[model samples]
Target chain A: MSKQVHRTLSESQVTAISEELNEPDWLRELRLDALQSLDELEFPDVIQTPGRTWTDLSKLDFEALVDPEGALEQKERVAPEGVEVLSFAEALEAHESLVREHFGSVVDPQENYLTALQTALFTTGTVIYVPEGVEAQAATIRTTMAGQSLFNYTLIIAEQSSSVTILERQETADEGDFDERYYSGIVELVAGENSYVQYGSLQDLTENTYNYGLKRADTDTYATANWIDCNVGSRLTKTSVETVLSGEASESQIVGAFYGHDDQHFDVDARVWHENEHTTADLVTRGVIDDEARSVYEGVQDVGRDAWNTSSYQRENTLMLSDESEADASPKLIINNHDTEASHSATVGQVDAEDLFYMKSRGVDEHLAKNMLVSGFFVPVLEEIEVEELREDLNGRIQDRLAQRTA
Target chain B: MAQLEIKNLHAKVNEDGGEEILNGVDLVVNSGEIHALMGPNGSGKSTTAKVIAGHPAYEVTDGQVLIHLDDEEFGDEEVPEELQTWELLDLEPNERAALGVFLGFQYPAEIEGVTMVNFLRTALNAKLEEREELFEGDESEDDEDDEAGYETSPMEGAADEGEIGVAEFQQLLKEKMEQLDMDEAFAQRYLNAGFSGGEKKQNEVLQAAILEPSVAVLDEIDSGLDIDRLQDVATGINALRDEQGAGILQITHYQRILDYVEPDHVHIMLDGEVVMSGDADLSVKLEEKGYDWVREEVYGTA
Candidate 1:
């Protein structure tokens, strides 16, 4: 067999990004290893039926060069007392061993093709560490991704009996001249025993960009992990979010929302594992698509054989604004233990004609009434979001999209 | 005086295998009068209300429902002293609503995610816009109105160019709720979502109070309502007619609600057309003897 440079990112460029991150030698080698794995790893597995697939990842070309020194612009925020919010570079400077212990610990580097690409080429990241028994209100991180190709990584660690809320938002740089671009994001959340971790994220990329994101958390005994992820933009987006209830009596809730328009496509997958006894989970997702846009959703609630007395439920609802738009969903529940209680449901439909007439009969304009219902469609998931500012932002982003469509 | 004239109206539910519902029904609701159109199932009473409101479900096959909107006082000018007569069939439902037409639903749509406050506020803005009362862009700031107790044309106040100010809207909604003896919590809930049967009926009346339409066609607002709720809703309807001086067309299957509301005229509908018309005694006789008398009296049957 002939040896060819099948990978787009090289060892030298991976090393360059690592050096820019101020990492140690071992971490640099890990980046290089991730770069080598990029060729072997494939895109995340997408569901397919006889007639069609939700998102055609095969058409996604990786021919764009990975910028060695991409835009890493993050607004600096001060951490609350007893909490540490530091850039990865600063984390290495002050808490070197802490970063080494937790980095790449929760998320696998070779989990998928995009994960490997982000693992190898990511230059900007942050670590939020809360020790035992610390109670923090909420911290916000806002950043902009620019250039031809960009990658982002985030690590959140909450210790025993501690509680913290992190709300992070990433937006596309509007002034950039890049015609077609790619964005990859990976998030790892660690929840210790009796702890509570809420991570809320919003991604509003440019329509010329493609986005791939994966967020997963591991829960300990009596620990709670909640994820609120919203996707608002991008030409194409495929996100996989997961939670593992590894400890007995652990719990998790994953709430998601997405709004697509102008030929945008989104494939969202959410999964929860009841690995131990007495664990519970709830997966709720709602989204809307319009103007030839499309969306696909897959949710899984797996109750292992030892998951006795567990409870898991899943629900997904989609609303379409335009007749040309389409949506599909698949919700699955695999209950191995007879003692467990589980249910799954999915519904895809257009905006209710009766609802529109009701509002209009009361004197709301047709366009405005449709926009109101669309805005209201996001409320259930927005209420599930822990951070008020993030919820408001997502709501505003939805309105903006609706306004553009109305125009 | 404003008027709503349903002139030899004809309509059909084309989607339901093209079944013609309203067959040349004629009725005229003058300002400050209450008329009840009573019918059994499929008598086309509710369809009249929907047709008056220009509901999209039914198509207007022929005839015209006209709305007479009078001129109003605007500063030094009597804007368009000549009354404008609009054909309801030509107008959208919202446009008809803007011209002081209201239709109270029998089963109000339970729209989740839209709070009562938001829906009411949007409706109020539409009303204001129709009357050219919207605070012009870059005109008076809402702060001034709030400081002076939210006074602006006695209507939905201006928020930010083309919107009613929040404080003024709250003040208006509060006054209407209090007038209707409604709980303050109703403003925060999704529009009619999870509402009890009676609550949904009351909400319809409350919306009518807010919109202050010149002509209100209430369809089965009394159904599923207990006597007490029926009385409360009837009292609210009476208040709207007496205060706003609006004409009302009350559509009902049972005479239970008419007992409280007191219709000036009672019309019995058979098949798709009104066959007989009378005063309050006629309704009482129908309630006492049942609709078999009407079927027999009108068509010489039973």
Candidate 2:
């Protein structure tokens, strides 16, 4: 229809997508404004030492990778009572005021270049709203991308005293001639006072794809937010999960995992900010890489000056299955308040031979024992996943990856 | 009867050009008997146990470790070479385990995520599969496979008749935990994670009880244990020796654990070689006289 739109974007395409979806004038303006911010915003910061810069994102030519016209359809899902779950477009149409109030409030759409790009091009997503004092369970969705590119956003709003569990999964649909597709997704969650929100997602796209994701949540007074983000597929992935304890005595737990094999590279980051007193945060991440694969992890726990009596702990471990593979971890604790209790630990090493030997001596096959240990390494974080199906799905995918590595 | 015979075994570390640790250490333990290997630090008492376990870190330069299994002692799992005795050197650690050889570690490795119940189930199922008694079920496993069809047979070895399901595994774990005097909640914890020294030893005994190995090599099973826990764990070891009639090769630097387990025979090892052998009194003598007299008696040094 329009010269088979290729890997570039213009203001016209953004306006056209908005019109195709029948979006309100305010949304169109938001998209166009995000488009304007792209020229000024830079990609997520990568850790740099004197000799090397980890996870180079500058090489990602967004113009060449972003197929602005290609977007996947969001699957419909059933929701619990007192909870409203709808496709992003449907939510915008039926609950425009509600959508406008919470959108881009928790996660700044113009925070980084990737965020700006996502805000400008995302055409498919889901919106979940749990009303005050309603406990909603089991809201799940799976997005299978079949096109050349995909950009999606998920917004979750939990009202005061409400509890909700949301699980999301993403993967490529089929093996197409265009092996190098692009996928970008962003999640914004707002937990109201005393509300509990749990968001878990696993991305296992084809190895020929490039993936980018930013999931951030903000918690109100005495609220809790938990995130489980796992990645096992994709040629290159740059994903980040952040939580801001904006409410006093709020709690947040970020549990993350990734497995990379072949030439796949994973740039994973988990950060937590303590903005209020007596807030608590726990960040745990584990990864395993094999066969020339590489992974870089950065975990940050920041306690603001006024956020006294805050407790935060961060732990990150990466296991290299092959000598050819590489892994790096940087866990930092920035505490501005003297009364805060903060600690961070990062370790990168090969599989523990003693642990393996112990399992093997117990009559487990060496290959299977190694698989168990690798799977076991992810347990501390996996235990944080409250959704049983998502936990099992993530585990099955990890076992699949380990089996492939063995083969 | 089941027996583990170490014949003039000579072994060395597999790394760094193989530093010799076990030198011509000959030993034997038959079913329904407990033999304590007593020695000072670096005397290779523990090395003998590891060498018999086929630890990957050690390579045997000469001699052999042979496990003789009788139909009365071990179930009907076809013995190789058409003989009841199988040499241990060629088998992997797990294979050795399937053949009814268990190694009780001195310092058990702490593994996360793998609960005690799950690990015990897998290990017991591995033993069952080796004996061709495991239930042949693939439905639960197939649900985990993707459309591309990846097979993750947890207990892999010859074909299996079946795998113990969850409920059955829990029942089995409960019985073993009770038998070992372990609390019910202990089975729910990650394998050896944050376990105390005595708890680790007790866990090893619990694994041995569940797997039902014919011969167990205990390497310093009493290390760091207090008098109460040493007696508690030794009682479990005694049950394995009496209830299953399994052979016990108790390797230790101190003889305190032997007080409760009670060895039928005690052997003193000095400088990677057995210097003297006798009844349980040998341990008391070694404790009183220490290794200097043994070195003087054997190498004319003291």
Candidate 3:
């Protein structure tokens, strides 16, 4: 076999990033190992029919997207009492032991090619930890990407019986001089026994940016984890949100909403594993694609053999606003336990003509009627959002996208 | 001059040059009159109503729907005209609605995500926009008119010139719901989604009450309604007529609803055309003899 030359990044760059952060030797070694794995791993494989690959991730040019020396600027809000929100550097300085113990535990460094790239090159991130039995209102992290390649990470850990909500927003600064950029965001959440954690993420990068995001959570006994993810901007977005109900009676809910327009593309995947008895998981995702945009969604609910009496449900619906727009969805259920209850449904369709005409007949103009129907299509998923500000922000973004298209 | 006039109307399904459904139908509904259009299934009664409302599905092959507005009621110093005539056939459905033409659908489309309150408020605001010339001057004038109980313009007190405030719209919707004996919770529900037949019919009536259109075409609004809901909807329609002097073209398959709301004129249609026209007793005769009698009377054979 011939050896392919695939090292757009070098060991020295990885060492430089780790050294710049003044990380411990173990963390630096992990980054170096992840950097080495990038050459061997390939972009995530997408579904392929007889003649066509649905999402061609290999088409992305990683060489043009690598900038190991890019700067990272993040603005974080102060978390409430009983909650500790710190940057990666600050966390390492103040709570090194705790950060070393929990960081990269939920999301392994060798998860995938994109995750390995993120692990090796991420320049900005935050660590949020909630004390035992404490209830914290919120911790907010906002990032603005401006350079050619930017990688960000977020880690959230809720101790036993503790509860916390985290809101992370990713945006692109209005710097028109930059070339087509790339973004990779990695998020890991760990909820301890009887703990609660809610994570809401919104990514609104510019059209010239390609976004790759992987978010995963681990739920302990009687713990609950909820995720609300909204993606509206990007030239192309490939994202996955997942959870593992590792302990008995643990629960998780994943809610996702996205809007794509103007030749943009999105490939979203969500998965949940009921590994213990009586675990429950619900996954709901709704999106709208307009213009020549395209989207693909895959949801997987896996019930393990020991996951008896488990309840898992998944539903994904995509609304197409234009005839040229396209969407494909696959919702799958893998049940290994006879006592488990699992259901999954996926539908891809255009705006209901009857619904549009009904509203128009009542004097809502054509554009407004279409907008209303599109907005309404997202209600089922939006209602799953437990945070008020996040829900409103997502709603406003959807409305803005609709207005931009019609305008 | 305030009337809805349909003259030798011809229409067809809009798709693929579909076959004609309404063939040379003529009707005139004047203000303050309730006209009952009685017909069997597929007699084009609903088609006529949809065509008048400018539903996009039915193309008007050749027709003229003229809406004549009373200049004293609609005109202001802007144009200073005594009467206004609009060719509704050229207008879009929403434009027709803005011109005070409301169509209560036989099977009201269930808008899954839009609440009844939002839909009604938007429709009411559009209706108000159509009458912007009526309240063109200032807010003080509106206040004075409100103090005088808005006897001059009942709808003016319901909406502002641009957009109705949310609280004001809620209040207006509540009042209309009360008038129709509808539950206040209905406002929060999706428009017509999962609603019972009676509830859908009552919701249509509630929309009419809120919009206060000059002319309302109720297409089989009483079809699925029970006796009590039929009476409530009838009373609501009567209230619209009495309060706004609105002309109603009530289409029905049976004479059940006419018992609650008397019609001044009853027209029996068959084969896409009106075969017989008479007073309210005509409905009773039709109920007793069935539409076959009208077919026989008009064609000289059963």
Candidate 4:
């Protein structure tokens, strides 16, 4: 077993995981193919300037981080009526055709090294299926990491005219027990024609955890998919939330908020691709970094050549609480067609002293005043969350972080 | 005895302290009196108000602002001796506010995402907490062993132990908004965000009414108000003064607001000093003859 654990991934490990899950021959073949691409593919390019890697993925020791033989513990909330939520192994056994048809359809396994690694060695996953014309309530997936390394995958299929909201939370089981752990997750969402899907994710892993997650959605005609991502923990976190508008008249809104403190590092990227005519995309993200923490946000709004009359707007703002904290943002608008309307803005700033004095003059203490400002800073994006519980949950977590700062 | 006194106050812009803005300024505002400070563009009327409120942009180079708290105004409990006389310049802006000093800004900052309800509640509760702590400390010093007995008893010193719950605060806000003829939805909106100039001034008046400060400083609160809104805001300010016996320091370049809210005393400020002081008719005189007359009267050349 020790000899089999080499720097480069072994095919036998891939076959072994697939066999352990009793996956079909096609899935086994896909895993082997993805394992082969790991050697050729490079980590996702995070830095645009040459000779500078803002978030260096090569520094991550994948050999020590990827445990192909790690145990998988899957726990999920009871599915809402007309909604079917199952683990990957259970889904492959009961709904093999549906699982095979939609899995990897939105996010290609060979997209990058991380994706390939996730595809080949994913230990635990969730599959949520909303039937046609069904308006299902929210389903929850709670992941608690208890091991040194864990890979997670989630696939959601909103059938025609169906709608569903999914809230996924990721955190460590014990506070400091899992001192050094690695987490990689992939979420693929497929929204059918006229369907709606809202995906809300809150990640509060322990400070010792290093996390990498990618969530992407594909929307059909008149379909809508909204993504709300809140990141507040982890020693180093790199997440990308993207949406592809593949159907005409479809809309996608990506709202993200993050609060980084201590020495944590957060690299957040949100993107939307307008692939069809008359599609609309709105991306808004707000974050606060304090202490010695650092955050970098990149937002991209791309209007393809054939996507006429595409309306895309992206805005990202990062508020720095401490002078020692650092933040940078880059919002890009790429319009390939002349008929598209697109705008992008990014701003990095500290709390406005005038606004602070204004509140303080009203008798609000300085500490509470700062907390209120930080809380209000996130309101623009928090208001975009369609789920009431999720919005309140995010607000509570923000308050907790502010309290920690005061403490 | 309950008054706000500024004695030979000297202040300057905090950045570099280039020149004194308020030089040897002395003024006294007693409870139940309205004093209008009229001045020209560069005469430092607004700077006085900001300095009194401990705005960080202004540095108080000399002199002191003393605030005397009225025991009956806070509650039936006796005010602590130490809490009675507060040095405004030594305290933070919020501390000054807690001691019943309110400054109505000329250009109120538009704070996005902070709802009017939330902001008002927090401010009001802070003041109440200050009162509660002072009263509690006073009562404990008088009766230490019986302190535990008063813990569960009805709070005669404060409204529910210095904290107003959401429903009660909303109700209070609604009542105050109605009194000011403000739209009910204004309470739910972000604090001063996207508000028209008149709306912003009216909101400031509403905040003053809610907080019920002992000395309310109005710095060009009537600048952007229309005739109707000016009358309404002036009416609200008058009501606050009448109901709470609050001292009013109305600072403006024009005497228009003085027409609606009558002032007992009017002072002309020129070159950062109170050059001339007179009765209400002084505002009418300045309105008709302009500041040239006051400038000539004080400087002997205009």
**How many collisions per candidate?**
4, 7, 0, 0
Write one digit per residue (lDDT tens) for candidate 1, span A99-157: 78877887888887678778887888888988999999887777687677777788888
DockQ of all candidates, in order? 0.38, 0.40, 0.33, 0.38
Chain A TM-score across all models, in listed order: 0.95, 0.95, 0.96, 0.95
Model 1, runs deviating above 4 Å? A1-6, A69-77, B70-83, B133-164
**Which residue pairs clash within candidate 4?**
none
Per-residue lDDT tens digits for candidate 4, residues B35-121, read 999989889898999999988888888998999876565766677676688788888888788878899988898987777877787
Clash-forming residue pairs, model 2: B134-B161, B134-B162, B135-B161, B135-B162, B135-B163, B136-B161, B136-B162
Residue B302 in model 2: lDDT: 90
Model 3, span B129-191: residue lDDT tens: 544523343443433221111111111122233367668888988888988899999998888
Cα-based TM-score, every candidate: 0.92, 0.90, 0.92, 0.93
Worst 10 residues of 2 chain B by lDDT: B144-153
Candidate 2, residue B148: how far the Cα is off, in Å = 18
At residue A11, what lDDT does model 4 achieve? 86
Best by DockQ: 2
State the lDDT of candidate 2 residue by residue for A243-282, as single tens digits: 9999999999999999899999999999999999999999
lDDT of 4 by residue, A299-358 (tens): 999889999999899889999999999888888888899998778899999999888888
* Model 2 stretches astray by more than 4 angstroms: A1-8, B70-73, B77-81, B131-175
